[model samples]
Target: MHTCLAFFIIGFLVSTTNGFYSSSDDVIELDSSNFDRLVMQSSDLWFVEFYAPWCGHCQNLAPEWKRVATALKGSVKIGAVDADTHKSLGQQYGISGFPTIKIFGSNKRSPTNYQGGRTADAIVEQALSQLRTIANERLGKRTGGSSGGSSSSGSGEKDTIELTDSNFDSIVIDSEDMWLVEFMAPWCGHCKNLAPEWARAATELKGKVKLGVVDATVHTQLAQRYGVQGFPTIKFFPSGRKDGQAEEYDGGRTSSDIVAWALDKFQANVPAPDVLEITNQAILDDNCAEKQLCIISFLPNILDCQSACRNEHLTMLKNFAENYKRNRWGWLWVEAFRQQKLEDSVGIGGFGYPAQVAINARKGKYVVLKGAFSQMGISSFLKELSAGRLTSPLVPLNGVAEGKLPTIIDSEPWDGQDGTLDIVEDIDLSDINLDDDDSDKMKKVINYRCPKFFQNNFTLSMQSLSVYARLFARAISSTEAEHILFNGLLRLSSSSVHATQSSNSLAITYPSTAIKHAVHLVTVSSGYSSHDNNEYECITKTKRRNSLIEQKPHPSNVYGDDAFFITKHRLGDFLGVADGVGGWREHGIDPSLFSRSLMDACKSLIDNKLIDLNPLTLKELLSKGYKQLLEDKQCIIGSSTACIVALHNEERILHTANLGDSGFVVIRKNTIVHRSQEQQHYFNSPFQLAIHPTIKDPRLIADSPDLASVTSFDVEENDFIVIATDGLWDNLPDATILEEIKQIKVS
Candidate 1:
């Protein structure tokens, strides 16, 4: 018997090295012909290794796989298939890498790829853990076999469960298993789009979780129970607690997302990270690695779990844990005060009590959870990760191609002074080119500090942020992009009269060689326009952008109503327009002051490249700015409509946030592609109805205008995004605007 056993072992080694592995009876050799028969039909859990014969990694894993198969023979099913020969089988399972291991859960349809360490021990450990979960589930099912389940049994029905008001309580409520149901209206467009995906997810998660659909229109009571406001609202009913307190699932609409969320919530049973867990080197080494993102949740305030934040912290952790079965991310929690190592690793132990940080051990990078630990915030964070929106590491000067890098030099830091000019009365204008002759000269727009009393400070101390201005000028060239033109000349009267307002408040003097004060407006002229009604037709000429300033501070300056705060703010490239409501003038209020105040608020907020840049954040930024403007002395009783356009050149995202009627447009190939919709109460009464008292008659009033129309669109290389106030949009039609654009010749 000993001799025979030795011979069998030798035979197994010989066959394994060959193309076939028939020597080992414990390891089931799978093929396209027998795959479904062995895997899909089997009741036990399966650990299938898909390997290519030519791959070196496959050869190394072969012996380890044999050991794993031998160790887990009776309780678990182990199988292997030569993926290179059975291309169809590999493609079905998405086997892009060699020696890919997959864990087939209780339901063979929903399989998870093994992202743990590539070792036999790790594989065995993960397999055993899953087996235990399956065992528990099966035991519970057997004990509760008498309980009536959904009439629409999850075993055979592969798609949506047709749920009505009559049978809703009986199956979903009485059953002790999770159910994902969609409340829908028959006529809804979004519901129609979601139908196929929902059906697919039901088929994928066949026996693991139950999926149901309700005709919300026909069943008003059921709809009201779940608070289904609109069409196709998806809600997840947690196992056993179907007291009608289902969670609303709102993230991605794909079938994969639905299935993933269900699996993450149900199958993952890992505990939240604590100081004990995070400090254990073994746990960190086992969990945190290249293929997985370790999300560390640290509660700073309380050491023990008995604190008030315990429940909230654990709930947030479980939310992250749901990602385990699908994405294989590590969800860790640590008490900040308990472990200084973990705290220092993620820069924690300040401010918020329970803080979360997502660290990518592979990339040596980490991202703090800046938003709340809620579904929307976590979803946004994960979405950004999948979309490659993580902050990129700064490249060193030497790392960049020598030819593409700009010259680096050290310069003296300028003093932080408020005054930029000596006197507000006298100024030089001869050297300041206001004509087409000096269109080729480089112009600068600088934002600086100045004393409140312009006449008091003679020699103003100011720092020149010329480096940013020069870089911005070089980036925005004539050939690549152009400042969107306005229908009328912006601030033509201001240039002619210095926009004195006749108040003699103070006539400010602008430096000849240099510009001193708030913002130095320079015009780089590319070419001329001859359209009859065109105020400023901004066209891109040679590769170099050399001309045109598009901001107008005074009301008579109708050429444009834009402000370039990007240079001074050092945030991002932004162009905005604010218009003084003409009706306010009839009420004895100088509407221009409110407009200027709004623009001033915008200037201050555009400081960081990331903040105040996103569509949602841009709306919030505008709201904050508007609120601040309302409290200002000049704008207390004044009302004005604002349209701001921020350009994220790095991300190539154009975020437009407008509170009132002032809008923008995107023209492509001589056609009006995108135009911001005018939000008017009636004919021409824009938002920002009033601040003093609610006026109802002569013009319609809306204290709030539908949450400021915020829109974001990805831009093409040379797409022109034009922003202007109602002065331009109300005056010219879209077709007329496109016609004017076609008139310009691309030189």
Candidate 2:
């Protein structure tokens, strides 16, 4: 079973295979992404390796395979499939082990097993040998066409016929003799090797079988119409066959072997209702002559006409013969030992009575029906074969790249903050004075709903809301606060008493943790009539609501070289930055989409209160947002090294979720407090979410808990939280990261 199976991986460049390949090696890497255009429809021959990344043998051969590829780059298409990642290709070919190699000829649909030595020189040699054989088959056909005729006389002169385009149809397609025509090319070395043997076999078979050759190089039409890819390509034409019916001859090359093969084919008979039908000119010379596949059956023979089962079976075959006549296909049965050589050629060993197989003489390939020997079963099998459904050498390419690693998020490391920090203060009643005795004083509570698809642009200029107030803007005007709001501020609160109910500037203070207390704005509104202004002076004032700080002390001090880290954020936690996977760079893809998109969605989750700023909520936020991005129509293709820190003030704990190689460390009393663990795959490949089309592992997605490592612990004031991506970790060990942090803390 020579089934060439591999995923053509496009856009891949190796940094090292736990090591690197030599520069002399020139193997094309294949994956699911580009197998069709590069391998299936290819005119060149391809020898592909199905290997696993974790296999020690494959790892060992990595360098040698590269050498093989470099040696045969132009003449033979060579590549490798990572079977570990492409399990479908492996299953289709039944690859139970790694480093399995198969060769695909021009027809791709037909593949041959490669059992030669594993050395680079050996692989190259084998490929070259096959190429020479292919060339010879074509040359023999082009120059031998003029001698097309009958030859019978155990004599050598009258045996072999030189068939040409003009006489091929009359002598081979329309003759009674079983035609064994070899499509050859004169320039091919393999054709030269088989010429003497073929001539001898032609003489020995004489009248029983007509041996002929066609120079495929000169007669391109017949050669192409019959799919002649290699030199010395042999095909057989059976009697009572259609113009396009031909079977390729795949057998031993010796003259005696050729004579024996033709004898069996010439004598091979199925007891059809009519003897003349099997002996017809078309049947004897042209049947299965055009690469068309034919099915033949082997059934039990009855000595007398008294066997009831035999009679019924004969009746069934007769009916089939009648029904399939329009198909121009023949159904014949040969008694046991009558065509033993031919039967063995098609693998008829260990079979019971009434066995049938469809064989393609063009490729010398066949498929046996495993189903019932009935109309429904046989018809179904033929239908599948005709549609090319059963034979899959070429597959279509679906455009969409999926991967788990992300491009680094756009970010900068946090500069240590000093002196004062923004802190949210509970609303104080002592500062406010309400006129209880005023005749027009009004106390009211208004519930507001956030608008769907809030652009979240800093200014509420899209509609009537404040850009900074978010949904709170709906309750007030942007001109009222006039303060630029940070990202993710959804709800807003305002407390105001109108001293005069007429149009007036409403003094508003967009909430900022204590530090931004002085930031305030005022606006005059025409919604209220001037006539009502003097009725009661209105003192309208709005205050800032929630605090979301944005800052990350260090981006790559803890995680891997490609890890992304964000420390203090505007929401309930610290800032965030994602250093996306670098893998997508070779493909011209932005790996940062996963992290940037997810982080952007996280802001919405915070504003909607869809998630809290606690450790668990952060996990939910990260996982849900990331998965949602994965499902987005405008989706992210790769994964990222992500790290986000959430401070659960209520629990007085700092919650951290580290995915890939991004991580953090908490410091107290100028000493290390807590740290995160790094996750990785072979060598430096970190475990992360890859879009489905790009990767097969489900655990790498955010929806899987194991994909992200989480931690929760206590924290105190002035504690330095150092977070970083893999860039810092890969270069600086843990002790180095902590040692530097200790110095910064002490300073």
Candidate 3:
């Protein structure tokens, strides 16, 4: 048996020597001679993957690495080095694993490890993020700040200040700066919950109102002085008050609520904005050119509406201006027909008078108010605008991007008085209808033009309306048909012609519910791939990917003494591997059972949606999975090392948590760019999670789930991730593994 195993090992080594990829691939091949000249001092960002072609994880990552290189070809420099081939180069960087990725930013000497996912999208995203960081660093240096420090804009200033009894009086009580202080105990659960919210509010309110926190347990004197009796007690100190008692903070505990309450207090001290009339170009430019946003209202002409109505409208504007004083936004009003060009550009025509629009002059974009012109409606609109919920369409602000508003014809402002009507001295009594009833006049007009002009248009409109009504009814029954028809109607309504041939064409060409059902059946029968077949498409791609890389099932999901799981979920795709510690076998424990159970528990959590993807983290999954095993009815006695990688669906981010020797690597263009670091207390004993009924045995080593190393990065399409145990890693050399799979063509 020993001689047969020796022969098998020899055969494996001889097959993997030639490696998996070639120089013709998209990945730029780097070696000892070219590494320094091309990458070390270059201005462009470099993401280099050190890979051994023989590594199964490296082979798996080959396709994704090619994709990443192609996607970031022009923006970033993507390269690969065969660490197995170039022994000297690999040793310089301490490349001990199958694949390792390093990002050479502005500081090339200390290149950071790329911790993102193996997929192309995730890699590209993280590469871009790193690029941005490097750019921001250079920008800071040019603007008189140190590298990685705050720019001249002072964005790096800490928003939250820590206060002790010694400094609390000088910073909050005796100073002129306004402050909101929270006194809390460390042991309190409520305090821990409020900590993040307090920090968020502080960051948002930076450079304005100060937010501070005091540890009530540690700073007893400060807590007692304020009569703090709860886990979290908040107090507010107003500006310009010294030696005065702080007011109790009775507001919602959310970050937004805290921000709103503090902003209200801040705004109380600010003067309300003046509702200036757009009488000339200077008034419009001076008020709006620099502000964050400008709120413009088009009121009826003073002569047309008279004083009472115009003053009332102006009062409403003034009230809103005062309420939003904290924003320091510009407020302006225009009379109807005074700025006809502006009205046309802002889509204010046909919408009628008393129209309102919020414009970002800098962006040259505006959103119109479609709701009522009352206070509540306006408030809701403004709130949506503040929350970035409103979608603003792009508009030309008369060369706003060029630092100028469109030319405004000089006009007189409202003179705070009603105008007298200018009556004509001469009247044409010959055209008068003094004796005619209103019905008789309407009948005359209808008789003259209604039949000839309205006959065709009215008939067409009625026919189209009926068709739409029927389509809408059909849509209620069939969602897909309804969506297509409704979109068509919206397009027709938005176009210049409402009841034209386009509407007829749409009504004629749109598929019926029966036709849609037929098409769906045909699509399913013919295996036509659409976006709706995403799961099928992914599965097909995965199968094809596996077939292309290797002829043999090397790095199988399930291996001897090791187990793994790959699951696709709504949140993202998850890949995990566990290496059953061989030490458990000495005590007659089936090590594989423990590892397999742990992986199964983790997979079940993902399948059942037990792991919420909102702000998804891999550590939470691993910790929870372990907790589940501890609570299991059949307590398995064993230990294993674990590694988990997750790809978030929406963000395309890759999150990873690793414990012990079982690890993963990301390969790009035949090179290993990123690999997980091994965790070990000593030379051979790796960190692991274990379950044992009795804890009195000192011989059994059990590590907490929290001890797992967590990392997150960006990923993209076609990236490869290889997750496996130390068995494969410990036995195979990089070149031997590469040569074994080199013949397998990725279909």
Candidate 4:
């Protein structure tokens, strides 16, 4: 037995190695015969391109296809087969075009086909979507079986269940299982789209539950019995002893939605079991209290269950539990699979694995540590729990404070309502001394700071300020003075912005004390833009506009200020960035102005004591910001992306508010501890809300436009928060920034 097992392992390794070589830099020419084996053998999802060598479009797409395939080699298996050589297979899949793409699953079932203009990214995305749908469908069926197992008739087959119109009476009504029956039309596009999912679900739940599809065109009686109003209607039959009368469930759902509904409904019918049966219930009962924060770990199996129970995550969980236990908050590890079974006995779909934590059960809030947990990851999780900030029900560890927090105001020159800036009168002539030309000075100022601010510390010595101003101007034009003030303030602010002993600091001096003390200059730049310049645009115009409009604020200026306060207040900090959309020059407004206005608005609010200091005050402030922008049309016209941060001293709270794509990332111990979710949207994005025609008010809701586009999160002391425009994010990954920030010694 041992020898056989060894031989099997060796064979598996050899096969993997062979596959690796075939997928290496040298593209292996594939034909029909090998394609099947390759697709069947891959553990990950596979995308196959069937193309004719002579087709023009196919020839044009060859290089792009190759690049995409090479890029997705490890995550997804990409293969191309010559259609001329695999004429039979191509014909089988109805491949009329020269280039056809299909996604094949691990089970070697019929592949999901794709047509039209094809690119590597497009193909990969499609394959992943299909894979997720397939996986979700399978998981749903498994969930349904254990929760609603009344329809089984001693069938052992995994994918096939015997269900006829005659037996439908006994199976659909009498049986205590949730039955999903699809009335499908053979030629219907919608039905065809749902076929693969239905079949997979049936196969997955074969013995535990029942699933059947009836061709509406062929089974007239079945259609009439269910009052089928559509060509493809699905009816769900709940499990029970209901005198064999079919319970009708409406259809017209995508396969995924259908499966999700079935699982939810089935689970709802069952009751949740007591926690004790799965493990030592007393352990959790003693440590965790209801309506309080508790970190629940998920143990899937025994191999790692023991280690997981005693792992570093557990240590942090224990510490948090001990600290917050007095608040009726605690932490405990629960086996996900075990809970799934227990919940099945009643009805709850368990989520997460290895180690998952529920912050506050009464609040229905939780966070899933999907992978192996570490000490730092656990600590980050605790901090988020303590703050009560989570964008989703699943709270992210080290999340930025959600909503708005009390803004730190140095001083207010005017009340925002009637505040007037005397641009000419306020201009300080002494602050504008220049030994260099305007252009040279602009270059020096704007180019002083690096584009990727989160990764670098901005520390400019007074002597180097002149040279730095020249560099800044050269790096960024059109708004050199603004850039100088912004970067300088950030450098100076960091020095005194200490929230905790481990917080980062920045200090700056503007030539003399009078220049620094008398005037408070705040410079804000727009986050990022999706629009590209047109052909009529001049090179210089494009360069200047793009540089100024697309520039993101230095991380030190945004999150650094928040971090400083988080440390000082003994709470987490909130920070964010916003990007503007539309043509910068064409819009007759600078994107930087929008950012500036927002920062100024926030500062003014803080200065006037208008901002609510408590944790709950965030939602209202965010609502106000959204409303103020919509009402102040002259201030902004084109769309903009925003991220906001809040810090609370008491309860050590940190929260963040966000809209559009400007992102907030949290890092702990050199790893990404949390990331905010982009607001839900379709082909178009919420980021484009500013420019969207129909969304005239552009508020969170029509009645509450002011608060429409906000999402928030919480934070921790050791957490490193990063808020950035898409420009910086496009070029760098979260992991890279985390590594850099980890190297920086916080003083």
> Cα deviation of 324 in candidate 2 (Å)?
71
Q: Write model 3 residue lDDT over 1-747, tens digit each, in one string.
A: 999999999999977664555667667889999999999969888989888756656767888998888888888998988887899998997675557787777657766566557888899998886666556555532322122111111332256677888988878878878899888776775565556557667777876788887888888999889899896898998887667598898666545457766876776765788999999989888888888889999886554355887899999899999877767899999987678777866766422456788877777777787565778768877776653445344356543345555667898877888744332233222332333343333233222212221233433332232222222222132344434433433322211122122222221111112212111000000001012123454355335433433343222222124556666677766767787775554444445556767877888788885546643467888888898878862445578899887766667566789999788765444445667877765335678998874435666778999899887775443344555566434433333223322322332
Scored by CA lDDT, what does every candidate get? 0.53, 0.50, 0.62, 0.45
Per-residue C-alpha lDDT of model 1 across residues 184-255, encoded as one tens digit per residue = 776775565566557666787777888888888888899998888987788888776566688877544545
| Evaluation by TM-score, superior candidate among 2 and 4 | 4
TM-scores, in order shown? Answer: 0.28, 0.26, 0.29, 0.28
Which is superior by lDDT, 2 or 3?
A: 3
- TM value for model 4: 0.28
- Candidate 3: misplaced stretches above 4 Å? 1-177, 180-207, 210-225, 228-234, 239-274, 319-328, 347-351, 375-384, 387-392, 397-403, 409-415, 422-747
Q: What is the lDDT of residue 417 in candidate 4?
A: 27
- The candidate, 1 or 3, that scores higher on TM-score is 3
- Candidate 2: TM-score? 0.26
| True-vs-predicted CA distance for residue 690, candidate 2, Å | 2.3
Model 1, residue 532: distance off in Å is 27
